[model samples]
Target: MSTLEQTPIGAPGGAAPAGVIHDIGYQRYTGPRLSRRHVVGALYGHSLRTAFGLGRSAKAKIFPWFIVGVVVVVAAALVAIRAQIGQVVLGYAQFADTMSWLVIFFVAVVAPELVSRDLGSGVLPLYFSRPLRIADYPLAKFAALATAVFLLLGAPQVVMFLGGAFTTDAGWSGVWNEFTDLLPGLGYALLWAVVFGGIGLVVAAITGKRAFAAGGIVAVFLMTTPIVGVLSVLPSTTANQLAGLAAPSSLVQGTGIWLFRDALVTNQEGGMGIGDFGPVYALVTVGLIAGCTAVLLARYRKAARQ
Candidate 1:
């Protein structure tokens, strides 16, 4: 009665072969195909999660989450201090300036994991086989990294805002003043995210080896600052001020000061004061971000073409 049957083969003196190709009612996919936009969105979400060490092994998550935990604890402590002192010990505008190194470290560690891993593992071809375009890959990756960095930098500022608002004694007016101050702080944080995220991703994109990429990112951030610091002390004030532009961190801090129209506070670490360098720092910051992005996109385009 059955039209299908199994066949067995074996050597004359050996046991019969045992295997079956079953007709278990497998079917071809008949669902609507997802468009390239959907694919890019999915990739973006996935890469964003990866940046924060979400959906990964505990070992993989320790660095990013530990950095996050440290920031949260520091913010909580600052809030408590502010409440007790009845004065702002750490203003939101200075938060990024204070924590810039940790942010740099985070970008160094995570950016390589996102882009370098894909390249090093020889998986780009597989990614290319999907509905995703070449440009879409880097754009999505950059967006994800930038978003992760933004959250890392922005969350503490939010905490600071709440802390400042609640501790103010002048009721709603105090809260309003604090809110006004917070807006510029948040804007500065976003600039840090974009600039740092762009540089980190571009460095990572240059190499497939995660170790090398991470090292390159760190060296670029760490080495340039000291070099600029040395140069800033030169006898020539113009040379000293111009030297500030050499360091990415300084550029970011200078841009923040310029954009926020805020005075250079003692706690702020990088760059010459806004008075010293003015809008050149901001222009250079924009240039650095734009240049890195162009290089990243161009690298991906070449990879996609090949």
Candidate 2:
């Protein structure tokens, strides 16, 4: 062997050599780090955009905008109906009730887009690895979804309000009255957003696959609604009153009727039959939101550790 080939590759006698660091000019960031609120706000805004498919591909936007279009068109039609017939066929609260199916569809489509994808992409742990607390991730998402749903329901109501306000025969006073009526409708919409948004996000978070998440969300909403109908028809008075508790839609509507019976229920006979259990409905609404939020936070906490 040659003299060079006879030598060990490392130090003398085949010992390994120590590694040396190669430094190009490198600098550490000395700038101030963003606070938790900024992170929460970012998550909230990004999630809100995702809820409506903003900044996403065209295909991603089609469904959200489609639902938006449908609701807006319906609002326009209601306005036209008012102008031509001089009758309010769909009141503000009723507008939300009329769009319940669309709301369900929107939540089904959107909740999955918000969280399921994060779970599927395996980025939730990465999210939790940062300054974001476990609750922050889900709560921020819930708020975004709730806000999106509020806007979804509110926009049409605004259209309805504008139509009513402009054509009022009583001048500004009538406009003020229309505005007052519309406030409850907006509040009711927020209630819907809270209940629906909370429940939908919980379902979506359970499954990583967006397709499955969406299906489960729809199934949850659709399945429970029939229970209300079945329960309301039963002979027992207690059962009839509590029937609205079965489905989220009825739960929210029951609460609405409780809070604003004069607006939502025209004739006494056509009411939701919640009876004296209206307070129960309101309580359940609060409980359902709290429960979902708790479950969501728990789920993310476990997921973060994993």
Candidate 3:
């Protein structure tokens, strides 16, 4: 046979050889691959959508209103105190101080809703069935809320610093001075947010009722702080500064500001150095935050495995 005639039948152009072709039926799937960016984007997009929807609705809008109200009240209070006392009020010194409260509020109130709403509406299961992973849920939620909290809490600090700088004796140089003065303050803000945010997430994960989570967060972070503060004064080692359940008191104490004064007037140096019990207090703060993270991860793993 000629070379052309001897070619196999199963070639692309034609089939000449008998029994050369075998049909193996398999459906080809040409869908796009899901990636981390896609997942993160979905999460971020959902968060923005959720926030927007809340704004459009009456009941949901309450949260934002509450935030605004808090800011307004705080601003007014600061002004009044400055006018009356010739110094800023306790707990109303800088934007960072006020923003700390906002972070605490967000954790206590908004966090439960983030997860509980989906769980209540039976949306969580559906999320798990898709390319969405359980781990991403907490991460996304934290990131979204953290970003908002930072903007809500941190941005004001920047503005306040700027305003205080140029409008007063604190120009750019003064701004830098205040910024340096507030480095510890910034760290305290982050420590507070992460610590409480993690607590809120863990509580939401553990409970079926969002109310329970919310209430628990309040009792643990808000009410417990004072209670622990009282206990810490009872002649115990943990009572001195470390006795409190959360980091706020220690942070405040470490910051050397008492009862929310603006002058940084405490006899203590605000523990700016790690050797100055700053490290010890920081380690405690980090430990609490780490615990919350562990709890969140463990809860997510359990849910995912189920």
Q: 1-306 in candidate 2: lDDT tens per residue? A: 222233345567665544544555567989999988899999999999988889999998999999999999999999998999998988898788889889999999999998887776767777876678888999999999999999999999999999999888999999999999899889889999999999999999887688999999999999988898899899999999999899988889889998978778852257577889888999999999999999999888877877
* Candidate 1, residue 52: lDDT: 79
Winning model by TM-score: 2
lDDT of 3 by residue, 121-153 (tens): 666666666677777777787666555555555
Candidates by lDDT, descending order: 2, 1, 3
Residue 141, candidate 2: C-alpha displacement in angstroms: 0.3
Which residue pairs show collisions in model 3?
9-15, 9-16, 9-17, 90-260, 91-260, 165-170, 232-239, 238-243
- Candidate 1 per-residue lDDT, tens place, 130-216, comes to 677778889899999989888887898889888888778899999998888888777878888899899999999987689999999
Instruction: Give the least accurate 10-residue stretch of model 2, judged by summed lDDT.
Output: 1-10
In model 1, where do residues sit more than 4 Å from their true spots?
1-26, 263-271, 274-276
List residue ranges in candidate 2 displaced over 4 A. Answer: 1-26
Leading candidate by lDDT: 2
C-alpha RMSD between model 3 and the true structure? 9.2
lDDT of 1: 0.83
Q: After superposition, how far is residue 299 of candidate 2 from its true place, in Å?
A: 0.5
TM-score of each: 0.88, 0.90, 0.69
